[model samples]
Target chain A: MARVEVPELPPDPTAATKVAELEVPPEIVAQTLGEYLRAWAARVRAGDSGVLPVIAGLAVITVVFQAISPHHVFLSALNLVNLLQQSAVFMVLAMAEGFVLLLGEIDLSVGYVAAVGGVIGVQLVQPATTRWPWWAAVVAALLACALIGAAQGTLITRLKLPSFVVTLAGFLIFNGVVLILLLLGPFSGYPSLLGDDTNRQVLYHLMWGTIDPLAGWIGMIVIVAGLGLALWLRDTRRRRSGLVAPPLGLTLLKIVLMAIVGLTVVAICNINRANIGTVAGVPWVIPIVLAVLGAWTVLLQRTSFGRYVYAIGGNPEAARRAGIKLASIRTWAFVICSFTAGIGGLLYASYLGGMSNNVNGGQLVLYAVAAAVIGGTSLFGGRGKVMHGALGGLVIGGIYNGMYLLGLDVQWQFIVTGLVLLSAVTIDALSRRGATTGSVAHV
Target chain B: MSDANVARAGAQPNAAAPPAGEARLQVRALGKHFGAVQALSDVDLDLPAGQVTALCGDNGAGKTVLTKCIAGIFQADQGQILWEGKPVHIRSPRDAAHLGIETVYQDLALADNLDIVQNMFLARERLRGGLLDEDAMERDAAETLASLRVTTVRSIRQPVGSLSGGQRQSVAVAKAVMWNSKLVLLDEPTAALGVVQTKMVLDLVRRLRDRGLAVMVISHNLNDVFEVADRIAVLYLGRMVIQDAASAFDRQRVVQYMTSGGTNGSG
Candidate 1:
């Protein structure tokens, strides 16, 4: 059955295609920001639409909450400020969740650990007990949380244990730890811990502290200007280096968007929504959240460690092939996650003014995941940002504030949140499908 | 090992290896077993510089097992891997990479969320002041793609997830070549690609050979083997049955050798 003549019918289209010039247009090489934006929007439509749905969902929910309630102040200054304050802890937790979520993993223990950290923190500053300084107390709690995360991550990475099972165990363990510590750890006396003004003051300061109006104004301007400058500088550098930079117009547009949102937030917080005289100015929690957001964003976007996290998430085999230490990156991801959760715990203690045995840590963890997913972090990983969690947390906070103002039951809030989470997950699946099929469709 | 060691070691290609393009990687008497099963046995192969050595076999003919062994995903139970001319132990993928060996898997082994440049420079990213040097990376990636004649991409900044199958395949190969890898192992690079995409990849393979890099392509398709490969090594039941220039065997003969493990099939 040997062929008499060697086959030649394929005719080497390969050679012809190889020799043909690509004819890359000059304009594409020198694309303006406007064209860059158009291309970006097209990419988004093809299914990489980051943060669009969250913003839309927030707007629609605000209007719906306003209409559903008889109160005319769903978007009121006082309510908006309350929403920001409420969002702070959840925002940080959601950002923490984003880390593992991007790695295609989940950390269920964050909520309880936050509570444990908060409890541990308060116990350290128990006035006559451990009597540690507030900063020291905060540092101890964060360290404890990081250690917990490291343990969980180690089991998951080195032991090859499933993250869900490990974190589920963690959820139970930490929740029990909080209860156990409360029963025996420092500041055990309920009244002595809660009754002490300084103990309450230091713990709640993050949640309850406020800055003067002038300070708020200056902070907003500085933050907005700083963000704008950073973005501008980055884009300018890319452009100068002759790489693909976003249009200056797009950069300015984003800065403008940030400015408007920032100014509105400052303005609302400055409004006196108090019953007696004037209770105004931005809360200290706002800046704390921003600082965390900025730091995490840079770590993820600008650093090699952050890039490896995403790489490991996207394709562990590929990352391993390229010489990345999968276990180390994964372990650190969980460590950072738990560490951030520790912050949330302190803020939570501050919000509630005290810790109790039945701290609803489970519900809080669920909300953190919801905030990240709703903000546009995919549950599948490799596609998210800290900012998504922040935005998602605000949306959750908005829904809660609006519904509470309307005198809605906690049961109603749960149903609404569950529905929103379901919607977000559905969107993520659909868009991911779109991404794979979208390219194939063109082919 | 030091750079001096690799350069000195790589200078000595096995004396009895292929009498063609400089032999960069030589595997001798390689054997691998999984439980009671002989996945690969006594497989001898040579990857010469400036040539495409296509590893051809039917399914379960130990093609992938042999590939994994060479890539150091699995250490051979019995055999020696010679890098350049020196006998070297490759216990892991890192060891293989250190020897300038890179494998582009069937999956393309790419991160979808990462852009073309990011995917290309994943673990080996250029850094300035302890941060990712995006400009340097993007520029280097663009230059690599350009040199490889992969001009179909709209932007190097676009995520690899958005790339076409052929484009993705080229990027994966380019990633392997970018690190100055002396040898690249491509596992069925054209398996899921269309005709045009396959052509694109085959051309890239030839371009890589032209650049004097040792390349081994594993493929079931005879047409693809003929299209790009300079030499075709056929495996049958965990053994190297035939090793000859691509022109030495036709489709029917190659198929017969792959199916029946007989020498008489060749013209």
Candidate 2:
């Protein structure tokens, strides 16, 4: 189709002539295209590269590749669950980074702090040692991460040092601590906690020991109710506040999608993974992650502290003039980021069935950052959501798992992951620039 | 909240007591030097509330320095600022805000990313239950904008960056008004505006005065000063060369005070 220009009407032209003269001017069409090109360039300059479209494109590619693959098991139930399990840890870690990124800062220490937390978490909850209750162990791990974050934050804020430098120092120091605490060598402790070589049993048993029929129903109902309550509250608030809310049909459609996905996942997991005849429901980590996501969403959006973090991210001077205690907010943001990373660490150790010094800090940190960025959190700050990390992590995990299933090597997986991260960031930059240039719709 | 609150207006010479149609912000022999360069020295200015006080000066004529001194961006090296009848020391922007003195810098300091309501409530957001009370803020913002009759804005939810030059100025003024500012110091409010927008802004300035708030406008536009100001204080080099009512100074004399240091035809 050729481009057409909407012609300007004469002050008192006849309606017929006006209609007749409505032909596209080549110059006008060229100008419109020029404007669009300029707008795209401007958007790129402004750093909003339209990451959503890029994510959508990646999803499309994934679906197409899976469809063309000879292996039918690639899209099967067990594989999907495995993919989710792989994503769980990274998703949480990405969330931790997302919080700090929203403050226009990065916590380079998160990876190692997470590694340290994993060591301590496993040690505390290791079935043989049983030094503490599982809940207490989890709490201790989280608090340890929080305190570590607070220490780093204090150094950065009070001393007014660049977070990059401070967190880099933290990364080095924490990594060392993790290695020393874990004893560095193989065979330092008891044999694998989940009884050697069976991937999901230990974590699955620990989180949801007995996932009978009743447990599955209970979990499904809880998830549906939670999603429903969230949607209802949001709509009601929007209505009360007289803001333009999504249509009722759209809202209901979203809730229905959530319910379907939740019910389907639970049903699939109940299909007897055990060859000896018993099966289980979804893992407890699913609900735990959901709960954490909800809590953080509220904290980052509903509270003054959350808004202040965004304000500080968007414009620090403006925040200061508003009398916001910058140091306190910055400190708290890091604390929350680290605390969440601790949860991620625990989940990772549980998944691995043991803590090891061989944990790849470099690769893990990149994946976490990639997950957050791909999910649509801006690296520049003040623009992201918890859901981004969760979604982005799933996408990254999918790529890794899919590549492995297709018999690709680790090198290829790394290459694909890097490409995805770059593309996502580019799109984000483009979209933001488009919005600032006033060429994008619904900025 | 400092020692400058000692010398009030009534305690100073040539300082008329606050009465109907008379408003004043009296500054004593204020001095400020940026290292060796004396930006301002023994500068005295009286800006009465309910009257448009035009602070006119050539480039580097200490007009901006003096304005900054009064607005608390810089602590005057020597002297005090008297609002109403109290001597006050302005140490920071917060201090000036507490005294109900607002300064609209040339940059406007409005965040482009934020919408009208957000920008209007920037640095002073209304909160309920420890969260930003969006509904309450929106309502107040709407009311404030409506009272000012700023109809150019198609939607308050639109980002301020999307606004025309004049609309942005309107938002900035509304922000000041929301703070319940007593004396608003406008630093070249209409500098970049078109004719129609400039008229709209001038009208808003008049409305500010009508609402009993004192306004100090700094402008190089003689047409604007003549159109809005009740008095003009022209600064040449580092000294205030002429202080006259708007009724007393013509365009020619005002320009003379602005360019050369003296007015030959008058005064």
Candidate 3:
């Protein structure tokens, strides 16, 4: 029973004699608080720092745009709130896109699928014919979107067709259905810029409605504090169970950051920024977006389904050998992607006051992919967080909003976004190449 | 050492075989065919508990076919697979796993993006309160690796992609044998390893055997076979060439049987 010198290993052993003095390379286990920080810093240097690059890029973009703008409106409470609202749809869409991206697959049809969902939602709640509650309509539309996703997933998984090709066809077909649906009714729910009375009531409330100020403050505190506690509890449990844990300092830092960001957003939205000066409260969309974001994070991090998603994305062969039902997981993934995209479509309809056949779904899908990629979700898959889309959406929205505040046209916005997207992709490619070539070993 | 010389020397040590007990898995008259091609025919072998049996064969010689059969990656067209001397049906990989059969394929079958414990408890994850019990899994993974004396990795929480080739291989093997698996099959476990890495894997293989598990290692490298194998089984052109204790033979005799199906290195 010779003692094997594994600093990370426990005292338990069977054949420790043969391994004694073998100099088994220590796993990247951090036994102490300082070592954990050092390991994390090393990982960041190794380019495994998930969303840091995207965050840094967003910061740089914000600073530059603020410097060039008239009143540094990038940091203005009103502008920031507007950024959140404007980016909310794209953010949801990007999170949806992250699923397929994580599986090393793509869904080009999500935009139109979303359109179909929105149209169905509006039609189902029509006042005269087949009036359903707003919640019911939302559910029905989501289910319909999921079915479309299942169909596409079946084509891609069972038929073994490339998702690019299948979803590209989906991109055309669903919106074609949207066009036909538009011709069927007068669509009284479509809002008139000059104030139309025929507009359905829920659409008006959902997109523009806000929580009262006191509730907003209370709600923000509860949610923020709750999330922090949940995160902290999870780590504490891991540590208590004698597993590796990040240093307490790191955990506290993360909780503090979450609180700061959450409170800041709440504070900004709580300010009265309307033209007439009476409108002040957090938009209902804010909490909705936050809820979705939170759900996506949980799905990706905690669940067995999430594990399989990463496994499939990382190595399909490995997942297959692990006896995971690759087809089922993949199909479900596509279903989830379209389901979230359906939410994005509803948001888009709400933001614009109606779904149009001419809605730039092609552009919407592109922006979704762009958001995920720019936020540090890998185009190659298996290396992204759902929150990456959240951050990326904010960046994209911030850019557009800041440009609007500077009085720039859509063309400038396009040019700047395209450049940012290009830089992000280049960064991704370079980092991956660096990883394969062992650049991270030194770090 | 000459083929006959190392054969004699290696043969003397483990002739009685299976330090733990009797054969756990026995295959008799196993036959498989892929269309007109006979991948395996009349393959008979015995894998006792607590010993390393090295399966050696030339390309297309049904060595993989046999390993896959035992691992339930493929079902034999004919013949009986007996566990503890009782005939049993092994159909899918899942069935094989249910029977405590774990195979570490040549490619390692690990998600590189995942951390160590995640990779270890991949499909068969331990759960608590309907969620992944991370603490329990981490503790188990650490214990498993330590019990196997696997200490090369700096952190069990680090992604598998960061480890060296040998470390990945070690993790795959540990994952296979950690959960009370009676039989562990490693397909070409050290096929692409360097000298030092190969030695590390061989040591790990011996450690697995000492833990009272039946380990069948597939290797083209005879030196590795000689280093860790307690028993040597050779498959030649989809037929059982020979199955004998390692001390009964050496490098040349095994290669001779592998290529020509000759007995004792003679035509």
Candidate 4:
């Protein structure tokens, strides 16, 4: 073998610098607000648009609906409140699907599984039947859903079956289960949460009840203050320790944005929305949804389990080699998905004041998937946030409310949502391609 | 070996080979085979700490099979592996890791979506109050990379997908060494790298040896083998034909052993 004498290249000037200089990029080490914004702009251009596209789409949607809505009622207090209530179910359901979606998997049975939760919760609390406390009923419902998820997850992981096929079978089976459960109920195929009993009223209020205006204001201020302080302290500590952190100005800007969003939500909910009597306060559903969002966000971002989920989704082979238990993690994801779907089901039953056989489980599942996708969650997995689900659900709710105000039929709503979902998926695929080609960077 | 051959081998003398008792890993009479085929037979190797041993072999020479056996990916049919002078059974990768043996596979086994720190601390994440201690992990990862002289990466926070090939390989090596590994098996670490990237990886390999870790590099490139290896082991058709100090053989002699399984023009 002949040896090729390769020419030696000159030493890189940066190689002799300090470790910090060599390891950190200039953008990451940016010290000022101007530098940070420029770095952010560069990232956006590289196709790491993050939630920017969704926010922009939401803004455009809000303006269009406010203009075209009959009597400009889309932004009115009554309609907006109704819209939030309607969106609660979608938001929770989308969040449920997000757990599996982050693992590059999908759950088709969430729709009916959620219905089952509502059935169990309402059935157990019936006056003539078990008469269990509302909390117990809710726990039983969530546990049942978790069991169903675990069964499905086990089949997919242990049996090495495709998740799509397993969940598809679950979808049909659970739908039947929901129907059979409703039939077996003490009520005549309809379990209503409407009753004078304290337990039943408490369950009903989960979605429909409102906090006092003054209490709502207090809660908003306290929450915003706590969150803002946490963010500020964490960033400052990291920066002081000479670690990678966002600029101080960026942290302040994020806090300001959070405050503004909180103020707007509370201010809107404080307005009177009733036709006959004064009905004013933040709906109980808003805080419930926000609590779920906050908990899930922390779970997915700050825990090793969450890191493993992303790792498995991105590359299962890599995750396996890393000593992560693929079966356990995948199973847990399904369980969480089903459990959260149960929460959504409870909200749905509460919103309608009853669990009827006429609940369109099929349509609800599709909308859940749609909401997650439109909220900027990637279908291919390893990318997304729980906050995306809430935002996307709001988009769906807005379209539904606007179409209703425009006197459009349900079919038009379906068509528009389908188109929007397609656009979102297209963006996801394109950005993924861009990332692979080195034209884009993932944050 | 003649004087001319010794001169051609390079300036390093055969004294670079450590005494046999200093071997951090010892493989004796190792034999492995499938139901109908013998992948390896009667293999003997000693990987001393603080040295790089380049395992040079042709494509069907059982280089990978031997490496896998040592990595505990495949159990040897017959053999005793002595870890620091005590025989041990390595039934799985976990067992090998427990004994401070880590393998950097050819594919690297790194998640693309994860950043450098995350990938390095994949399953072994440090947690405080049940939450990932990102600060501690980052500081440690950064220090490890710096110690390895891996200065190519822009930031430890950037995702592995955005890293160049050489940088990714460096991260993999760093991950392996960070586990206090006594022996690191690198399979074709520079196979897909260009000239510069290859040099970067080779430099990292040398640094591992300098840090008192036993490094086994499997490569077909004799140029790299001669450049970095203190010792050379040539495998041919599931048989170990030659194992000696790098200064004992020139490139032609090593290639002759690799192709013919003998230096005397005999199979």
Best by TM-score: 4
Q: Candidate 1 iRMS, in Å?
A: 11.5
Maximum-lDDT candidate: 4
Per-residue lDDT over B196-266 for candidate 2, one digit per residue giving the tens place of the 0 to 100 score: 67887887787776666788899988899888887788888787777767777789988888888785423
In the range B128-203, model 4's lDDT, one tens digit per residue, is 9999999999999988887776766766887787676777899999999999999999999988887878898997
Q: How would you encode candidate 4's per-residue C-alpha lDDT over A211-253 as one tens digit per residue?
A: 9999999999999999999999999998898777878998999
Candidate 2 recovers what fraction of true contacts?
0.13
Candidate structures ordered by lDDT, highest first: 4, 1, 3, 2
Alpha carbon deviation, residue B52, candidate 1 (Å) = 1.3
Model 3, B76-113: lDDT tens digits are 99999999888999988998988999999876489877
Please report how far candidate 1 places residue A299 from its true position, in Å: 1.7
**DockQ per candidate:** 0.32, 0.18, 0.37, 0.36
Worst 10 residues of 1 chain A by lDDT: A18-27
lDDT of 3 at B160: 79
Question: Per-prediction count of colliding residue pairs?
Answer: 2, 25, 16, 0
User: Which segments of candidate 4 are over 4 A away from where they belong?
Assistant: A1-29, A437-443, B1-15, B264-267
Off by over 4 Å in 1: A1-48, A67-71, A185-200, A437-443, B1-22, B264-267
* Model 4, position B74: C-alpha lDDT score: 93
Candidate 2, lDDT over the whole model: 0.72
Docking class of 4: acceptable
Point out the worst 10-residue segment of candidate 3 chain A by lDDT.
A18-27
